[model samples]
Target chain A: MDYGWLMFCILLASWLGVELIAKIPSQLHTPLMSGTNAISGITLIGALVALAHTHEPLTEFLGYLGVFFSIINVFGGYWVTDRMLKMFNNKNNRK
Target chain B: MNTDIFYVISSILLIHGIKLLGKTATARKGNFISAFGMALAVAATLWQHPPQNILLTLTVALTGAYIGLLMAIKVQMTAMPEMVALFNGFGGMASVAVAIIEGIKLNYIPAIYYDTLIYFSLFTICLTLVVGGITFSGSLVAYGKLSRKLPTSSINFRGQEWVDVILFVLLLLSAYMWIFTHSVWSFYMLIALSFVGGCVFVLHIGGGDMPVIISLLNSLSGVAACAAGLILFNKVLIVAGCLVGTSGLILTLIMCKAMNRPVKKVLLGGFASISKNKQKSTRGTYKPISTEDAYYILEAAQTVAIVPGYGLAVAQAQHAVKDLAQKLTDNGADVFYAIHPVAGRMPGHMNILLAEADVDYDQMTELEPSNARFGNTDVAIVVGANDVVNPAAVENPDSPLYGMPILEVFNAKTVFVLKRGQGTGFSGLENELFFKDNVRMIYGDAKATLTQLSAEFKE
Candidate 1:
């Protein structure tokens, strides 16, 4: 896609984001934040591309750091969110 | 399926995943769907564009994933705010790494190619670097505050606002230099300035106002990612980043609204100074309640409202609180939790802490409704909470916390405040509720007080 097209997508997605997040209740705000944190780790793809296309020492090091950070962000964010969400279930049977 | 089509599918999953997260029944499934989408996106990227040095990439990625999962497992429920802040810092730094990698790649292209590309690459590269740096450092500051590594007080000095302005102006000038002359030093300067700018911006906000700053920084992290996506023209990154950016902004706005602060002032460190505004306008002194007397009073109360704050989690009293609530329930008292929007360090913090103790979400109530019901409540049992239940926020006009929404615990027939000592809250605002005639302060560690109160009920 061209630069202009990418900008358009960014704008559209932002509009989508506002609409998507506005409906969430205040009680679920924490999980919503954590869940989106994981989604931002989609930058892992960008990092992978950097590592794949470069052979320079600086690029390799930076690319590796990017991969590492994004990977943890993805796994940690999602898992932590899941763990938190697991606690929110209604357990009427509990004595 | 076309490899390109996989990106489309994953994007759909992400959008739908967030949509589901708003609902309690579907929230867990939403997390699962989002993770599944992320996995699919990663797999598609790996399959379509296999890395040249797969060994090194896998090693780093796997190691990161292991650490992330381990933290997710090991982190205490009460420490969720700090963990989330730390993760946000890593995500922010990741964007910086992505931007730097792209910037290096751009340096390889001929100078004429920069003009042909509309100077767009330079702008996105520079923007990504500054914003990413800001998010990383700002998030780290947030982490420090949440974890108590740094004092939770806002560190304000003379000319702090001027310093922020100067840094920002210099940052813009460097960005211009980087874009026009492609100077390497200008690029590095941008990085340094943004990181400093972030720390300075966040450092100026008061500890009580940290939840707002953290939310705003979380938004910045997403914007940085979006800029990185713009540099690479990646669809999935753009969608995910944009989604996170807007959502974080909305969350920040919601927090500001909840606290009755404007977005501009919150960012400008409007509430930074640790104000010592302790006005005792109410009649009568704070009367301490013995656990035995508290139990007698509680046992006879038919309706109870429990107002909890960050201190509840700090004292790890959630389980004790639940036990007391159960005891109250069995004693023919209807017990419910009253949650203030900005109750804990992060949004919904108290909910997570209480949920960890198996408290059903149904048992919890939000501010306005709980406020409306407190007038009818026989007793408002405030546990380890100060600022949120402070009557001064609404009663006294001169207070720093004035106009901020609070739990009107004084409206109840009897108010039992579980606190540690005579000190003020995080904002240093002396609780006006404590001095009210109906209010009885129970000074001690919250968990011990709750357990003892529960034991009294058992007798």
Candidate 2:
């Protein structure tokens, strides 16, 4: 299997995903983006695998970057999500 | 330079950050934990051989940082959800890009060890692309509806469900084919179908359920990243993705449970529609009060508790309500805010809105604590809120929200409700409290009515 072919498939899928999401209206973007961020946060798994396998200096370096970004994606994503969820708490005791 | 030291530091930051998020009082500290963790991770990465392409890395990091900072500073609390969706989309996009780069590089490695690694990378890349794409598009649509750029009702096109199902099946089939046959076309089709499925799924869902849907999508994105991380054999991505996915699933479930509905029911899109039917009721006989008369009563009251709702959000009356509360306090009246757990469109909506008005947090109490004292309250002021205070929840066993806890504002000595009209609440139920003998309907915009009440209190 040619590496370029695999890479093309990955790139194509990613571009499509981003473009489709971008086309959604602005109002839904937060939850939608938050959901996708959770998906992106899954990159943590990739970072872990990279850590386990990589011995080469270049591979180790990329693995480190992956780990850092993945952590940010997970932490920042959940924080924003929690904040958004808090927006629904209303204090109106009308009954 | 021990790599173990970096890992230990990062792990500690993550743990501390999570702890900070556990308590309401330490929420700000939680934000700091997140910042600290990211900084530590970045420092560790930089220390592991300075970036060869310093300009590229710095440029991307700076660009993302700038945009994020701008949004944090400029975005109103109301628009926070949409901003979250955008950021999530960016994260998924990033993962997909990384997976692709890794897939390309895998070709350069020897074919003997290629089967496992290349296949895993391919699978992850495709999964991330499809799921990420769908989440991105769906979130935008949700944002539009929430911001009123589009209507909040279900957009039911003919055969919408059938189309979505077909697309979903096709997406699965494509994934299957890609794994079995290793065909590029299968991968492309899978991506296309998944993207289309995302759009269709979100479009069919009504605005009321966007929060749950968004949370679910967030989980999906997390799983996608987890898969990618596994493909790349990156420990951090794996851990981070798993944590996010688990947390997201839990949050989504909690949101659904709070509504007292099943996840399937929420996803199916009929709840809000059923609510629409209940909105229309035979007109009941009830005396309404003018803003002036209500203001007079409020002015004479010794204790006032303000209950806010979606109406306040619509009227943008948080500031006015705060002002009213202050005036009541100044006039020797005890004032408190009673917050129901699920009052606004989402959880904690009222707190954020009121906080923006500089309302003292100490004066605000959760429903459980305040309800115990409602009978002693001289006047319970309800501003643009409904449902959560509905007496039907207590008396009607068949009621959708029956057995659900509510703020007993009706138990107060006098209840003054400020509303524009007798509109149904988010749950689509007519509030019996509106017609209670002790209740007075003060009709108008929340802000204006509160202003009137505040002026009278001052006099």
Candidate 3:
């Protein structure tokens, strides 16, 4: 795989995603930040891949820790965002 | 099986979910949809690469999830900012761990080095460690301040900017050595310096700048995750990381615009020095009002707007504020909250505070609309908020708050400020609104004063 092309794509996509975020109103910034923090938790996939490649004892230990921390970020982030978003009173939830 | 199909599907869902979050009505559903996407991605990954010790992996994942759930359930609304900060820290630390693991593997398993790929992989790994470590420690410091475990005031020293530059250069040097020499010691050194750099980077930013700091660290974590994905050649990870990183960067920029400062000025060192002229002379004294008198004014008012700030958090006055709003509503008075972009130390702090109080969501207004309403408002109640409503933001160009948009509460027919004393706000600038002829200051604890005012409505 050509690393240069892949990195360029990642940078471009990320820039576009941020442009989307800029369109959101400031009132929604808190939830958006929290929501995106949850999105960053996608690193759990990386940790899983690391664990799968575990060969040596030290490598295995690092992989385990990676998975552990990423799990916390992922599960914790989503749940917390859900909790916060639930409080956003709007017309749909007013009743 | 390529399993790439699952990656595509998950990425689409994640994007859709994030897009949905732009509106209040759909935000909650968006959160759930994103979570589902996350789960799908994780499940697919685990399915593709089933670990030899399934039990051990399961145990670790479950334990982590359980802890996260408990914390999310237990934390109060006011602590949400710090909780978000800590979560970002966790994400950064996780990426750092994964990057290190991948780096070790890359070094040990002499893989086919295609032109520049080896160099790119090594560079990304180093970048991940530096950025991830910084995000982790910086978020911790932010959490400490938000939670009152550490000083909320930005701690600055002589030659602080130079110190930061020196640390950053040293960090780059260490990372370079680790990459070229493959020396484990240099790698450890890089990690240590990265952590320290993160702390120093944020240490001098005052409490008022926390929302920006939090958002920036959130983005840094995203950058770290993306770098880790690059090192590991994980497409999904790379996509997700970019989404998060860019969004966070935009949020930081938004915050910087709200503060009327350049992003570079904020990152180099923030409003710590804005208060250096603390001995600035006061222009006029403020008039104090009793609760009964304030209530009478509020009662006679046809429209009222409440502006809350970090002071409300300190006084835990959100509930009382809500009750007061309800009473005003009961009296046939129009009531709404004016929320500044940077209000309450965190984004949407005022909204969540009011939400927790079960206030009608429609009653909350942003700065622009709220300012428009202020001209028609009969009474503007400043509740433990100072800087956001300070008229100096517009009237005095020399003021630090100048050019920053404010609530325009000073335009109201009558303004009543609820405070404990004649203290300046978090930014250390005295509010010109306080000394205005039409304004009245009600001195007391915010919660207690608000409770008293609410009782006056009952009378």
Candidate 4:
């Protein structure tokens, strides 16, 4: 598969995603932003691969740092988004 | 090859998860679905690649997750913006590390590589370095401001703008030198300059514009990740990166609309802090109304609209506001909440607060819908909201917020503004709505005032 074609498809898909997101109510915007932030943590895959492929000390150090930061981004973004969303109680649950 | 099929499935799930997040009732499920997809993607990647230092990888990941979880759970709702900033910074830094690794690896490849591929790889590394560096340090500055560790006001020194331009140009120069000379020194210099450029880029932005800056940084982090994916030829990374980047860009646009400014103006910087000098003008006098008077007027109104702002968030008055709205509804008044895109510090900040109070998603109206109904509304309550409802956005061309889109609350037959004091809003701009004949100020803490007003409606 050609890399250029893949890049084009990704760009198109992303545009569609944004169109869908724009339709969401303003109430969920914060959670949506944070949720996407969590998704951006997909760099974890690249980091792990870099670590596995590289044998040099300098590359290894960079790889470990990448893995560490990627984990923080993924976990923190999702958990905080979940906690915030939890606060949004349904009206039926109201006292 | 086996992992490609799994990656495709993972990408589909990610897209599905984001789509489900559009509505209120399904948002939590959507969040979990996205996490599930992320887990699957990570597992597939590791399973296929099988890193050499597995123990170290797992150890770092576990430790990072533990610390991240603790921070997420312990942070207060008021500090959410900073929490988001920290996560974004982490994402950016991760990309930076990945880019450096890829850049080093590229050097080991034989010079026989396809010309386009080599150039593309170099360009991607440069982009990842600059964008990721900016996102990381800028987000840190934003976190500092939000947490009050750094000055909330913009910090500028003489000739700072020129310094910023020079730093940016130097960053580009270093990237160019590294590409042509393949010098490790030039690469490290590029990294250092980018980090400094990132900090200087955001330090001058005041707290008021932090929300917009945060969103922009989020987008940059995504771009950085995408560049990293390009370097690795990882399909899933590319897909996820593009999704986040586009979404963040759209969000940034919405925020600019809320502020009634162009993207260029925001990027050039200093619009938010510039408003500080225009603080208080001896505009028209405001009419103050007691709670009793406010209650009397509210009881007779056939329709009511509530406009909320950051002040409402500061006072934690969403619950009380909900109670008042319920009271108004029970009395046979049509109650609707007018939500401006930038009503709170961040996009949907007010909506999140309202949702926490269990306000039905249906009753919350947007700027356009509420504005259309304002003329028919018998009473409009401005709960600790100033800038959004300010008539100055429309009527006063000379005002800082003159062109911003504001809630047309003045069109209502009667208006009551619940505020703490006579001070200007977060933007430090005077609201001309306060002086209009139809507007009345119910000066007090938002929660207390709403509580008192709700009590008057009790049988």
Best by lDDT: 1
Q: Report the C-alpha lDDT of model 3 over B119-222, residue by residue, as the tens digit.
A: 78778989999999999899888888888898877788888768888998898898888677666777778878988987887777787888788999999988
DockQ, per-model, please? Answer: 0.81, 0.10, 0.76, 0.71
CAPRI-wise, candidate 4 is: medium
Off by over 4 Å in 2: A1-95, B1-5, B46-52, B100-114, B217-221, B276-282, B285-287, B397-399, B427-429
Per-residue lDDT for B22 in model 3?
87
Residues B120-158, candidate 2: write the lDDT tens digits. 666666676676667656666666666778777677655
* Candidate 1 error regions (>4 Å): A90-95, B108-112, B116-118, B274-284
Alpha-carbon runs more than 4 Å astray in model 3: A89-91, B106-115
* Least accurate 10 contiguous residues by lDDT in model 4 chain B: B270-279
- Best-performing candidate as measured by DockQ: 1
Residue runs of model 4 more than 4 Å from their true location after superposition: A1-3, A56-58, A84-89, A92-95, B105-118, B156-158, B270-282, B455-459
Q: Judged by TM-score relative to the true structure, which candidate is superior, 1 or 3?
A: 1
Superposed by TM-score, candidate 4 places the C-alpha of residue B79 at a distance from the truth, in angstroms, of: 2.7
Counted clashes in each candidate structure: 0, 65, 0, 0
Candidate 1 chain B least-lDDT 10 residues: B272-281
lDDT score, residue B229, model 2?
50
Better-scoring candidate (DockQ), 2 or 3:
3
* C-alpha positional error of residue B201 in candidate 1 after TM-score superposition, expressed in Å: 1.8
Candidate 3 local lDDT, A1-95, one digit each (tens): 57687868697768678767878866678888888998898888888888897788987887778788777888778887787777764434557
| Clash pairs, model 1 backbone | none
Q: State every prediction's TM-score relative to the real structure.
A: 0.96, 0.77, 0.96, 0.91
